[model samples]
Target: MEVLGHRGSRVPGPENTVEAVDAALRAGADGVEIDVRRSADGDLVCVHDARLSRPAGRAIVRQPTEALRARGIPLLDEILDVWAGRGRLICEIKNQPGQPDFDAPRERTARALAERLRARGWTGPRPTVADLDAGAGGITVSSFDWFAIEAL
Candidate 1:
C-alpha cells in the first residue's frame, strides 16, 4: 500500500519539477511518478508536455536542455540526484507517436533511459521492498509506446 504521488503532488511546486518531488517526499509520499522526455541536445528532461505552450510556445524537442532549464524544466539527472536513495521513482517515458519527440522503431528514448539507469548502478534484477528500505531505492520505467517498453 505504498502511496505514490502523481507528478510529485503538483501542489508544492510545478508538476515534474525537482521541487515538487522533494515536497512530495517531505509530505510523506512513499514515491513519485514523473514524466521524462528528451531535449534537442539529447539530455533527458522532466516535462509532461511535448511543447512549452505557456512560456515558450515551442516544441520541447526543438529546445536544448539549457533553454528548457531556463524555463524551469528540471533535468532527469537533477531529479535523480535530489531523490537518490530516498524513495521509489516511476519515470513515464513520453514517446507517443503523435508527440513532437516521438521515436519509432529506433526507440532512442528507451535506449537512452536504459543507459542512464545502468550508469546509475541499476543493474540485475529489480530491487525488492527490503532493498528499497535499505536505501537502494526503486525505479520503474513505463511508456505508452509499446516499442519503447520492448526496447528497454
Candidate 2:
C-alpha cells in the first residue's frame, strides 16, 4: 500500500501550498493528495474551498489565479511540474452540493483537467501501484460529484 499525504501533509505550512507538499515528500510521504478548483480565469488552483472567507472574503471562482497565489494559493500545474518524476499525485476535484459554482456546466472543469493531465501524458484507466514510484505514476482525478465522474 502507498502512504499518500493528505493535502500535502497537515503538518508544515498551509494545507495545500507548494511548501506543504514539498515538506510532505521530505517527511517520507510516498505521494500527496491535493485539491483542485478553477479560478475566475479558468486556471486550475490548489485549494480545498469554493470560497475563502478570511483573507479573500470571496468565492474562489470569483478570484483569479494570480490574486489567489499572492494570498498563498498554488496552481495545479506548479505542483504537477514538481511532482512529475519525484512522487505521485492524487488530485481531488472539489465540488460541494448546493454551492453556486458546483452545479451544471461542469464540462469546462472536466476539460481543463483532461488537458492538464494529457499535457503530462497521463491517460488510460485507473492505476494500481504497489508504491507511489511504480509505473508511469501521474495524477489521478477524483471527485464527489457524480456528474463530474460521468462527464470525465
Candidate 3:
C-alpha cells in the first residue's frame, strides 16, 4: 500500500509548507496530498481553507502570495519545486462556496495549474490520480466541487 501524507504530515511543521513535505518524506511517505487555492494575484497557493482564518484574517482568494507567505502559507510552485519527480502529488483544489463568480475561481485555478505544469515541462495529456499514484511524475488534481473538476 502507498502511504500518502496529508498536507505533508502536518506535525513537525505547518500543513503544506516545504518543511512539512520534507518531514513526511523523511518519515517514509510515498507521496503527499495538498490543497491548492488561487490567491488574489492569480497565483496558486497551497492551503486548505477558503478563508485565511487560521493563517490570517483575510480570504485566501483576496490575499496575494507575498501576503500569504508572510503568514506562513506555501505557494504551489514552492511545494512542487521541493517534491517534483520525487513523489506523487494529490492536489485537491479548494471550492469557493458562497462566493460570487465561483466559476471564475475554478477557471483561474485551472489556468494557473496548467501553466505551471507546462512550464515544468509536462507536455503530455493531463493524467489522473490513478496514473500519478501508479508512478506518473507529476500531479493529479481532485476536488470536492464536481463543477470545478468538470471545469478543468
Identify the leading candidate in terms of lDDT.
Answer: 1
TM-scores for all candidates: the values are: 0.92, 0.86, 0.83
> Which residue window of length 10 is worst by lDDT in model 3?
97-106
lDDT of each residue in 22-81, candidate 3, tens digit only: 788779788888888888888898987778776455688888779888988888989998
Off by over 4 Å in 3: 54-57, 99-101, 104-106, 123-136
Tell me how candidate 2 scores on lDDT: 0.78
Clashing pairs in 2: none
Give Cα-based local distance difference scores for all models: 0.88, 0.78, 0.78
What is the Cα-based lDDT of residue 91 in candidate 1?
90
Per-residue lDDT of candidate 1, residues 1-152 (tens digit): 78888999778779998899999988988889999999999989999999998665688988988999999999999999878857899999999988889988898878988999899887569888688777566889999999998998
Please tell me which model should have the higher TM-score, number 2 or number 3.
2
Candidate 2 backbone clash number: 0
Candidate 2 least-lDDT 10 residues: 129-138
**Candidate 3 total steric clashes:** 0
Question: For model 2, how does the per-residue alpha-carbon lDDT over 21-115 read when each residue is reduced to its tens digit?
Answer: 88888897778899988999999999988888776458888887888998889998888876765567888878767664585555567678888
- For candidate 3, what is the lDDT? 0.78
Deviating ranges (above 4 Å) for candidate 2: 125-136
